[model samples]
Target: MQSHARGHLVYAASGILAVHTERGTSIVPANRVAWTPAGFTHYHRAHGDTDIRIVFLAPSLARLIPDHPAVFLASDLAREVLLALTGPRNYDDTAPHYSRSARSRLLRVLVDELREAHEQPLHLPEPRDDRLQAIARMLYETPGDNTSLAELGKTIGASTRTLSRLFRDELGMNFYQWRTQLRVYHALVLLADGHDTTQTAYACGWANPSGFIAAFTNIIGTTPGRYRTSRQTTTSGRSAKSKV
Candidate 1:
């Protein structure tokens, strides 16, 4: 039921705000961080100031945190320690930079501090009832429908304000944020099925494909064209996982 966890978080400080999950939503703020447990449906974002840096730890490290949701402080020491990790480190034993002893020392410090930090849950402000679920599913499955809040509210017997609040509370996201996430997810599915962004955006109801592409890049860290190329490379590397 949470959005993130069982995945590592790296504190990359910069000023920008964006987070999207292939499934979950993201809430990015400098004061606090939200981490959800793995297979738990979550997302994260970087804010819009400048010089932003965040590193996602692998699932192996993420599993160490229990209870899924956590909020931690970006204290000076914590920040400094995390920042230290950004420097290049070597993994190969044969490389000149290899130093198992040093690597172990740094990792121990980083993990101990990170694990001991306080936890915060990424929360939705509204509650989700059957009505909201129905509407949400409809929007998700058919992004091109262009259903307005008024229309959806009429169908659900609630005021537009009520529905909007519900989205914020239960989903921990605003209407726009939630809709964008849904669009991004569908976009991914289309790309997976071999449709390009130009085709996917229109099919998904984006007024202009570029607009959708902009959203995709902001949330996903790359433009659709690059995303496809990079995805293909990554997929090829992991194709074996699909066979079994």
Candidate 2:
């Protein structure tokens, strides 16, 4: 990130996404876009079959916008503007329709769209109780296998009936719902770290990409690619800058 610069936005038409940070992990969907601040060490994940676009802006331009990281509501017009900006012509002054003047005009409209769009954060609650938390961690760390509630119950040294009771008493939501949300959260992170949909879906205990995307859309409000694109970061693997 350039000094005085902030973060960028990723536009996703379809995909599953996740971001992991020092703060925690967040999973996002296609219907929403994310704004990550500059200097935040984060990674993103997405489905393999997605056509995603990433847009980076300097801090000067970003400052005129809100600072908090939030998801922007993607309207048809807004989505079109984003798609256009992703094109080389959109930012080229020489292009008749995408001249410098046109770029500036388009930029203003895009910024307004961002500021007014509905915002939502991709977050989920973990069990607060020590016992439940332990169980939750185990389930999350091993999502690949077909580990059932009964299996988890044994690991926790509690009967399945007792574990079910404990979940209701401590977390409010039932066991299956809790697990679903947890998987969704993990799926996001896996995708952001460069894991493809097949890998992430399977890791999240999903049988296939379709199954994963189905849940991702319902829970995150968008497909994985769109979610990952919204929070797209700069290409971190670029050649290192020459020292002064």
Candidate 3:
């Protein structure tokens, strides 16, 4: 757990990154960007061979964004700007140097782009209640567990009604909804590691690939197959470029 003096945006050019804080975890795939405000204790874990890019924002610009941790869909413009700001120019002296005014303009454009982009539902809020935490721990340990909430409640010595209420008040979602998010988070990690869609679906607790595809699409805005293919293509392209 660490905190930064300046707020920063993290983009995974390839692979996946999970940002964990007191609030919860935010899953950042290639199509998304994760923002962590200054002074928020957080840690990151990368899945597969990840290419991570980070751009720190000044206080003046950080105020334009949400104060809390969030995940946002990365538009094409946002992606390009992020890549430009954090790209190889930092280390390559032969590359053109951006003037201070030019860099500031780029930062403003990046902030504006983020302001217009939609906030993604990739954040999984942390559960404060002990029972809820227990349930979360169980699920996190085994996302494939198909146990009902009532049954899970029994193991934790809480009535189903009590657990349901806590789920609403504490987590802001029902058991199934939270579980689905958890499953999708796990599925992303699995996919990043090169697992097949069918195998990932089963590993993440989906009864069938179709159901997993629907839920994955609903949250991620892309099919698992397409996402994997894109990652593969990006990796191959990078490899070929490096060989040149």
**Top candidate when judged by TM-score against the true structure:** 3
Evaluate candidate 1 by giving its C-alpha RMSD to the native, one decimal.
10.0
Backbone atom clashes (below 3 Å) for every candidate: 39, 17, 0
Local accuracy of candidate 1 as per-residue lDDT tens digits, 155-199:
878898988888877777777776776677667656766688789
**Alpha-carbon TM-score of each model against the true structure:** 0.54, 0.53, 0.93
Clashing pairs in 3: none
Sorted on TM-score, highest at the top, how do the candidates line up?
Answer: 3, 1, 2
Identify the superior model by lDDT, candidate 2 or candidate 3.
3
Model 1: worst 10 consecutive residues (lDDT sum): 235-244
lDDT of 3 by residue, 121-227 (tens): 99999999999999999999999999999999889899999999999999899999999999999999999898999999999988899999999999999999999
Residue range with the least summed lDDT across 10 consecutive positions in model 3:
235-244
**RMSD (Å) of each candidate, 1 decimal:** 10.0, 8.2, 3.5
Better structure of 2 and 3 per TM-score = 3
Q: Which of the two candidates, 1 or 2, achieves a greater lDDT against the reference?
A: 2
Per-model C-alpha lDDT, please?
0.55, 0.62, 0.87
For model 2, residues 185-223, the per-residue Cα lDDT tens digits are 777667756777778888888888898888878876778
